[model samples]
Target: MNTTTAATEANVTVATIRDWARRGIIAATKAAGRWVIDTASLAHRIAIGAMKRPAKPARKATFSVETMLAIGGSRWQKNGMDRVYINNWANFLPLEIDQYKTGNISWAAWEGQEIANRQALLLLGSIDKVWFDSADGELHGRFGSGESRIATRQEVWETVVAGIRTAIAAL
Candidate 1:
Protein backbone atom coordinates (compact mmCIF):
# COMPACT_ATOMS: atom_id res chain seq x y z
CA MET A 1 0.00 0.00 0.00
CA ASN A 2 1.10 3.60 -0.58
CA THR A 3 2.05 5.92 2.37
CA THR A 4 -1.28 7.79 2.19
CA THR A 5 -3.36 4.58 2.19
CA ALA A 6 -1.32 3.08 5.08
CA ALA A 7 -1.67 6.31 7.09
CA THR A 8 -5.43 6.47 6.47
CA GLU A 9 -5.93 2.81 7.46
CA ALA A 10 -3.70 3.12 10.55
CA ASN A 11 -5.48 6.35 11.71
CA VAL A 12 -2.20 8.33 11.80
CA THR A 13 -0.71 11.24 9.87
CA VAL A 14 1.10 10.81 6.54
CA ALA A 15 4.19 12.40 8.12
CA THR A 16 4.19 9.81 10.89
CA ILE A 17 4.09 7.00 8.30
CA ARG A 18 6.92 8.63 6.34
CA ASP A 19 9.00 8.93 9.53
CA TRP A 20 8.44 5.25 10.35
CA ALA A 21 9.53 4.30 6.82
CA ARG A 22 12.67 6.49 7.09
CA ARG A 23 13.54 5.00 10.49
CA GLY A 24 13.05 1.45 9.11
CA ILE A 25 10.45 0.87 11.86
CA ILE A 26 7.92 -0.49 9.36
CA ALA A 27 9.11 -2.29 6.23
CA ALA A 28 8.48 -0.33 3.06
CA THR A 29 9.89 0.07 -0.48
CA LYS A 30 10.29 3.00 -2.89
CA ALA A 31 8.29 2.90 -6.16
CA ALA A 32 7.19 5.70 -8.56
CA GLY A 33 8.96 8.33 -6.34
CA ARG A 34 6.84 7.33 -3.26
CA TRP A 35 7.07 4.97 -0.29
CA VAL A 36 5.05 1.73 -0.58
CA ILE A 37 4.43 0.33 2.91
CA ASP A 38 3.86 -3.43 3.23
CA THR A 39 0.21 -3.71 4.30
CA ALA A 40 0.97 -6.66 6.62
CA SER A 41 3.76 -4.77 8.48
CA LEU A 42 1.58 -1.68 8.93
CA ALA A 43 -1.34 -3.82 10.15
CA HIS A 44 0.88 -5.65 12.66
CA ARG A 45 2.30 -2.42 14.06
CA ILE A 46 -1.18 -0.88 14.46
CA ALA A 47 -2.64 -4.00 16.14
CA ILE A 48 0.27 -4.17 18.64
CA GLY A 49 0.43 -0.34 19.15
CA ALA A 50 4.18 -0.36 18.37
CA MET A 51 3.85 3.13 16.85
CA LYS A 52 3.44 4.78 20.25
CA ARG A 53 6.31 7.09 21.17
CA PRO A 54 8.82 6.04 23.82
CA ALA A 55 8.45 7.34 27.35
CA LYS A 56 10.49 10.39 28.33
CA PRO A 57 13.05 10.24 31.14
CA ALA A 58 12.07 11.72 34.47
CA ARG A 59 13.51 15.18 35.27
CA LYS A 60 15.35 16.06 38.47
CA ALA A 61 13.72 18.37 41.04
CA THR A 62 15.49 21.73 40.69
CA PHE A 63 14.39 23.62 43.78
CA SER A 64 14.26 22.51 47.41
CA VAL A 65 15.14 23.96 50.86
CA GLU A 66 18.03 21.52 51.33
CA THR A 67 19.46 22.30 47.91
CA MET A 68 19.19 26.04 48.61
CA LEU A 69 20.99 25.61 51.93
CA ALA A 70 23.79 23.61 50.32
CA ILE A 71 24.21 26.25 47.64
CA GLY A 72 24.18 28.96 50.32
CA GLY A 73 26.83 27.13 52.31
CA SER A 74 29.12 26.85 49.32
CA ARG A 75 28.61 30.55 48.52
CA TRP A 76 29.27 31.51 52.15
CA GLN A 77 32.53 29.60 52.18
CA LYS A 78 33.48 31.17 48.87
CA ASN A 79 32.92 34.58 50.47
CA GLY A 80 35.70 33.74 53.00
CA MET A 81 33.71 32.60 56.04
CA ASP A 82 35.24 29.76 58.02
CA ARG A 83 34.03 26.24 57.16
CA VAL A 84 33.13 25.46 60.78
CA TYR A 85 31.19 28.71 61.12
CA ILE A 86 29.38 28.20 57.81
CA ASN A 87 28.38 24.62 58.75
CA ASN A 88 27.10 25.70 62.17
CA TRP A 89 25.12 28.62 60.77
CA ALA A 90 23.69 26.45 58.00
CA ASN A 91 22.33 23.93 60.54
CA PHE A 92 20.72 26.72 62.57
CA LEU A 93 19.09 28.47 59.62
CA PRO A 94 17.83 25.92 57.03
CA LEU A 95 14.20 25.90 58.15
CA GLU A 96 13.63 29.58 58.97
CA ILE A 97 15.12 30.82 55.72
CA ASP A 98 13.29 28.18 53.74
CA GLN A 99 10.06 29.29 55.33
CA TYR A 100 10.80 32.92 54.52
CA LYS A 101 11.63 32.23 50.88
CA THR A 102 8.66 29.91 50.38
CA GLY A 103 6.39 32.73 51.68
CA ASN A 104 5.22 30.76 54.71
CA ILE A 105 6.20 33.76 56.84
CA SER A 106 6.86 37.45 56.31
CA TRP A 107 10.47 38.68 56.02
CA ALA A 108 9.85 41.51 58.53
CA ALA A 109 8.49 39.06 61.10
CA TRP A 110 11.31 36.62 60.51
CA GLU A 111 14.01 39.27 60.80
CA GLY A 112 12.44 41.17 63.70
CA GLN A 113 11.04 38.26 65.70
CA GLU A 114 12.75 34.97 64.82
CA ILE A 115 16.20 36.41 64.20
CA ALA A 116 16.08 38.78 67.17
CA ASN A 117 15.45 36.00 69.67
CA ARG A 118 18.02 35.14 72.37
CA GLN A 119 18.61 31.72 70.81
CA ALA A 120 19.72 33.41 67.57
CA LEU A 121 22.16 35.54 69.51
CA LEU A 122 23.61 32.47 71.19
CA LEU A 123 24.02 30.70 67.85
CA LEU A 124 25.95 33.71 66.57
CA GLY A 125 28.02 33.81 69.76
CA SER A 126 28.83 30.10 69.44
CA ILE A 127 30.57 30.74 66.14
CA ASP A 128 32.27 33.94 67.36
CA LYS A 129 35.80 32.60 67.48
CA VAL A 130 35.56 31.42 63.89
CA TRP A 131 33.34 34.03 62.19
CA PHE A 132 31.29 36.37 64.36
CA ASP A 133 32.80 39.11 66.56
CA SER A 134 30.30 39.67 69.39
CA ALA A 135 32.31 42.60 70.76
CA ASP A 136 32.32 44.50 67.44
CA GLY A 137 29.09 43.08 66.02
CA GLU A 138 30.93 42.02 62.87
CA LEU A 139 31.21 38.76 60.93
CA HIS A 140 34.86 38.21 60.04
CA GLY A 141 36.82 35.45 58.40
CA ARG A 142 40.36 34.38 59.36
CA PHE A 143 41.84 35.95 56.25
CA GLY A 144 40.13 39.38 56.07
CA SER A 145 40.23 40.69 59.64
CA GLY A 146 41.47 44.08 58.46
CA GLU A 147 38.60 44.57 56.03
CA SER A 148 35.96 43.45 58.54
CA ARG A 149 33.39 46.10 59.47
CA ILE A 150 30.59 46.06 62.01
CA ALA A 151 27.42 44.39 60.76
CA THR A 152 24.01 45.21 62.25
CA ARG A 153 21.32 42.63 62.97
CA GLN A 154 19.47 43.47 59.75
CA GLU A 155 22.67 43.34 57.68
CA VAL A 156 23.47 39.87 59.00
CA TRP A 157 20.01 38.58 58.08
CA GLU A 158 20.25 40.18 54.63
CA THR A 159 23.63 38.52 54.09
CA VAL A 160 22.16 35.09 54.78
CA VAL A 161 19.21 35.70 52.44
CA ALA A 162 21.53 37.02 49.72
CA GLY A 163 23.69 33.90 49.97
CA ILE A 164 20.63 31.68 49.62
CA ARG A 165 19.48 33.62 46.51
CA THR A 166 22.95 33.43 44.97
CA ALA A 167 22.97 29.66 45.54
CA ILE A 168 19.55 29.16 43.94
CA ALA A 169 20.66 31.15 40.85
CA ALA A 170 23.77 28.97 40.53
CA LEU A 171 21.52 25.89 40.26
Candidate 2:
Protein backbone atom coordinates (compact mmCIF):
# COMPACT_ATOMS: atom_id res chain seq x y z
CA MET A 1 0.00 0.00 0.00
CA ASN A 2 0.97 3.65 -0.34
CA THR A 3 3.02 5.20 2.58
CA THR A 4 0.12 7.44 3.70
CA THR A 5 -2.45 4.59 3.57
CA ALA A 6 -0.07 2.26 5.44
CA ALA A 7 0.66 5.00 8.06
CA THR A 8 -3.12 5.61 8.53
CA GLU A 9 -3.74 1.85 8.96
CA ALA A 10 -0.83 1.61 11.47
CA ASN A 11 -2.21 4.60 13.48
CA VAL A 12 1.17 6.39 13.14
CA THR A 13 2.45 9.42 11.21
CA VAL A 14 3.73 9.11 7.64
CA ALA A 15 7.05 10.54 8.92
CA THR A 16 7.25 7.82 11.54
CA ILE A 17 6.56 5.16 8.87
CA ARG A 18 9.24 6.72 6.62
CA ASP A 19 11.71 6.74 9.53
CA TRP A 20 10.89 3.10 10.34
CA ALA A 21 11.45 2.20 6.72
CA ARG A 22 14.81 4.06 6.68
CA ARG A 23 15.90 2.40 9.94
CA GLY A 24 14.86 -1.05 8.65
CA ILE A 25 12.33 -1.39 11.51
CA ILE A 26 9.69 -1.96 8.79
CA ALA A 27 10.20 -3.24 5.26
CA ALA A 28 9.20 -1.28 2.11
CA THR A 29 9.82 -1.44 -1.63
CA LYS A 30 9.35 0.91 -4.61
CA ALA A 31 6.80 -0.14 -7.23
CA ALA A 32 6.26 2.09 -10.36
CA GLY A 33 8.23 4.94 -8.65
CA ARG A 34 5.96 4.83 -5.56
CA TRP A 35 6.95 3.49 -2.10
CA VAL A 36 4.92 0.38 -1.22
CA ILE A 37 4.83 -1.16 2.28
CA ASP A 38 3.83 -4.85 2.45
CA THR A 39 0.57 -5.14 4.49
CA ALA A 40 1.35 -8.73 5.45
CA SER A 41 4.74 -7.82 7.13
CA LEU A 42 3.36 -4.63 8.72
CA ALA A 43 0.30 -6.48 10.16
CA HIS A 44 2.48 -9.33 11.45
CA ARG A 45 4.86 -6.89 13.17
CA ILE A 46 1.91 -4.92 14.69
CA ALA A 47 0.32 -8.15 15.94
CA ILE A 48 3.61 -9.09 17.64
CA GLY A 49 3.89 -5.48 19.05
CA ALA A 50 7.42 -4.89 17.69
CA MET A 51 7.16 -1.17 16.77
CA LYS A 52 8.40 1.26 19.47
CA ARG A 53 10.42 4.50 19.72
CA PRO A 54 13.75 4.47 21.57
CA ALA A 55 13.77 5.84 25.11
CA LYS A 56 15.66 9.04 25.91
CA PRO A 57 18.42 9.16 28.56
CA ALA A 58 17.99 11.00 31.83
CA ARG A 59 19.88 14.25 32.59
CA LYS A 60 22.87 14.25 34.95
CA ALA A 61 22.75 16.23 38.17
CA THR A 62 24.74 19.41 38.64
CA PHE A 63 26.43 20.74 41.80
CA SER A 64 24.33 22.75 44.26
CA VAL A 65 25.26 25.63 46.64
CA GLU A 66 23.58 23.99 49.65
CA THR A 67 25.74 20.89 49.34
CA MET A 68 28.89 22.97 48.96
CA LEU A 69 28.03 25.06 52.02
CA ALA A 70 27.30 21.99 54.14
CA ILE A 71 30.58 20.33 53.24
CA GLY A 72 32.59 23.57 53.59
CA GLY A 73 30.91 24.57 56.84
CA SER A 74 31.57 21.17 58.42
CA ARG A 75 35.21 21.37 57.41
CA TRP A 76 35.47 24.91 58.84
CA GLN A 77 34.20 23.78 62.25
CA LYS A 78 36.40 20.69 62.24
CA ASN A 79 39.47 22.86 61.61
CA GLY A 80 38.76 24.89 64.79
CA MET A 81 38.34 28.28 63.05
CA ASP A 82 36.82 31.05 65.19
CA ARG A 83 33.03 31.14 65.07
CA VAL A 84 32.88 34.84 64.23
CA TYR A 85 35.31 34.53 61.32
CA ILE A 86 33.56 31.46 59.97
CA ASN A 87 30.17 33.21 60.19
CA ASN A 88 31.45 36.28 58.36
CA TRP A 89 33.02 34.23 55.57
CA ALA A 90 29.92 32.08 55.31
CA ASN A 91 27.69 35.14 54.90
CA PHE A 92 29.67 36.69 52.02
CA LEU A 93 30.75 33.55 50.13
CA PRO A 94 27.20 32.37 49.34
CA LEU A 95 26.42 35.01 46.69
CA GLU A 96 29.38 33.96 44.56
CA ILE A 97 28.81 30.30 45.30
CA ASP A 98 25.17 30.63 44.27
CA GLN A 99 26.21 32.19 40.99
CA TYR A 100 28.48 29.23 40.33
CA LYS A 101 25.85 26.74 41.42
CA THR A 102 23.31 28.27 39.02
CA GLY A 103 25.81 28.26 36.15
CA ASN A 104 25.92 32.05 35.92
CA ILE A 105 29.68 31.82 36.43
CA SER A 106 32.21 29.38 34.96
CA TRP A 107 34.28 26.96 37.08
CA ALA A 108 37.48 28.88 36.22
CA ALA A 109 35.90 32.17 37.35
CA TRP A 110 34.75 30.62 40.63
CA GLU A 111 38.17 29.09 41.19
CA GLY A 112 39.79 32.46 40.55
CA GLN A 113 37.56 34.15 43.12
CA GLU A 114 38.26 31.34 45.62
CA ILE A 115 42.00 31.85 45.07
CA ALA A 116 41.56 35.60 45.62
CA ASN A 117 39.61 34.99 48.82
CA ARG A 118 42.44 32.80 50.08
CA GLN A 119 44.95 35.55 49.29
CA ALA A 120 42.83 38.21 51.03
CA LEU A 121 42.47 36.10 54.18
CA LEU A 122 46.22 35.65 54.22
CA LEU A 123 46.80 39.42 53.89
CA LEU A 124 44.35 40.07 56.75
CA GLY A 125 46.34 37.58 58.86
CA SER A 126 43.25 35.43 59.23
CA ILE A 127 45.04 32.54 57.56
CA ASP A 128 48.62 31.72 56.68
CA LYS A 129 49.86 32.92 53.29
CA VAL A 130 49.08 29.76 51.34
CA TRP A 131 48.70 30.12 47.58
CA PHE A 132 47.87 27.79 44.73
CA ASP A 133 50.32 27.89 41.80
CA SER A 134 48.28 27.26 38.64
CA ALA A 135 51.45 27.08 36.54
CA ASP A 136 52.84 24.02 38.33
CA GLY A 137 49.55 22.87 39.91
CA GLU A 138 51.05 23.05 43.43
CA LEU A 139 50.10 24.81 46.68
CA HIS A 140 52.76 26.92 48.43
CA GLY A 141 52.89 28.14 52.02
CA ARG A 142 54.27 31.47 53.30
CA PHE A 143 56.81 29.89 55.64
CA GLY A 144 58.68 28.17 52.80
CA SER A 145 59.37 29.03 49.15
CA GLY A 146 58.84 25.46 47.93
CA GLU A 147 55.41 23.95 47.26
CA SER A 148 53.82 22.09 50.22
CA ARG A 149 51.44 19.94 48.18
CA ILE A 150 48.45 19.82 45.87
CA ALA A 151 45.05 20.31 47.49
CA THR A 152 41.37 19.83 46.59
CA ARG A 153 38.63 22.46 47.24
CA GLN A 154 37.67 20.80 50.54
CA GLU A 155 41.32 20.70 51.59
CA VAL A 156 41.64 24.38 50.66
CA TRP A 157 38.66 25.18 52.89
CA GLU A 158 40.33 23.25 55.71
CA THR A 159 43.53 25.26 55.24
CA VAL A 160 41.60 28.55 55.27
CA VAL A 161 39.81 27.58 58.47
CA ALA A 162 43.10 26.50 60.04
CA GLY A 163 44.54 29.91 59.25
CA ILE A 164 41.55 31.61 60.87
CA ARG A 165 42.02 29.43 63.95
CA THR A 166 45.70 30.42 64.14
CA ALA A 167 44.90 34.13 63.86
CA ILE A 168 42.23 33.88 66.54
CA ALA A 169 44.55 31.90 68.79
CA ALA A 170 47.19 34.62 68.44
CA LEU A 171 44.74 37.22 69.73
Best by lDDT: 1
| lDDT of candidate 2 over 50-164, digit per residue (tens) | 4464433443322232322332322123353222113333222111221235544221112122334343333223323443333343333433222212343444556454433
Top of the candidates by TM-score: 1
Per-candidate alpha-carbon RMSD to the true structure = 23.8, 24.1
lDDT of 1 at 60: 44
* Candidate 2 Cα errors over 4 Å, as ranges: 50-171
Compared with the true structure, the alpha-carbon lDDT of candidate 1 equals 0.47
TM-score of each: 0.29, 0.28
lDDT of each: 0.47, 0.41
Question: Lowest-scoring 10 consecutive residues by lDDT in candidate 1?
Answer: 105-114
Prediction 2 TM-score vs. true? 0.28
How much is 77 displaced in model 1, in angstroms? Answer: 41
